[model samples]
Target: MSLSVWVPIVGLLTLGALFALFSVGIAPIVGPKRFNRAKLEAYECGIEPSPQPVGGGRFPIKFYLTAMLFIIFDIEIIFLFPWAVHFDALGLFGFVEMVLFIGMVSIAYAYEWRRGGLDWD
Candidate 1:
């Protein structure tokens, strides 16, 4: 395109890069330097950490199942946003496509539910 079109694009990219560099570069110098047993220890994945395996050496399958569910729903919601925003313009074709997409996802969800993939111990 023309210089006018490219100028803003280049400026925006440069600004984003500068902001990321500044934030990451300043954090080490300005943030806390203290380190002790707790700080050095592996995080407990949200629960109270101990000097042992985070989940008592046996990881919970529920956590992974929940994470996968979150990702699946998250992606579905992301797709819905664009379709929603352009619903009127997309008309019947878009509606049918979205219905098919939802149907496929629903089938997968039903399969998972039937297979106990959504269940927790």
Candidate 2:
């Protein structure tokens, strides 16, 4: 690349570094120094942290499986969106491929449904 191209990159890097330095240096002097039980305690998913159970509060296997299923379906949509955006360029072969992918996913979904993978309780 040319020197002109590098100028903006270097300028942005310097700007980021200056911002980080300023935030870190000024925060200690300007920001709140409060430390108390409520502020220090962990908060997650808008819920207060509960007392730990025995055996380190093991979550159910169903919870992990549901999370994985959500991620897998989410990724499938991510793949489909690009193909849909380029539908005309991809033509018939892409259409067939997408159909097959959906068929497989449908089968998986049906299997899971049959096995009660989608049940809440």
Candidate 3:
């Protein structure tokens, strides 16, 4: 490929890097300098943070299930965006493949739902 085609990509990358660096560099200078015990402590969604056990206690299985479900749905979105962007080019074969993929994901979701993976109680 010609080097000209890479110019826009390189420009965007440079712009992104500069923006990130600028934000990080400016934050400490312009942001709040006040510090207190509460500000230093770990935040737990606005609730008082609990002390960690000495043994680093195992997390409930529900946490893992929730994380796995998030990953599953995230992957579904990742696949879907590309397919949707190229829908016209992909045609019927792609449509069928996506249908099968969605069906499989749906089955997995149903299985988890039936297994109480979604229940908090």
Q: Could you report the Cα RMSD, in angstroms, for every candidate shown?
A: 4.2, 4.0, 3.8
Pairs of residues clashing in candidate 2:
none
> By TM-score, who's the top model here?
3
TM-score winner between 1 and 3, please give it. Answer: 3
Better of 1 and 3 by lDDT: 3
Candidate 2: where is the Cα deviation over 4 Å? Answer: 42-57, 106-121
- Point out where model 1 deviates above 4 Å: 44-59, 89-100, 103-121
What would the TM-scores of all predictions be?
0.62, 0.61, 0.65
What is the overall TM-score of model 1 with all chains considered together? 0.62
- Best by lDDT, which number? 3
lDDT of 2 at 92: 96
Q: Arrange candidates by lDDT, descending.
A: 3, 1, 2
Decreasing TM-score order of the candidates: 3, 1, 2
Give the local distance difference test score of model 2.
0.81
Ten residues in sequence with the least summed lDDT for candidate 2 = 45-54
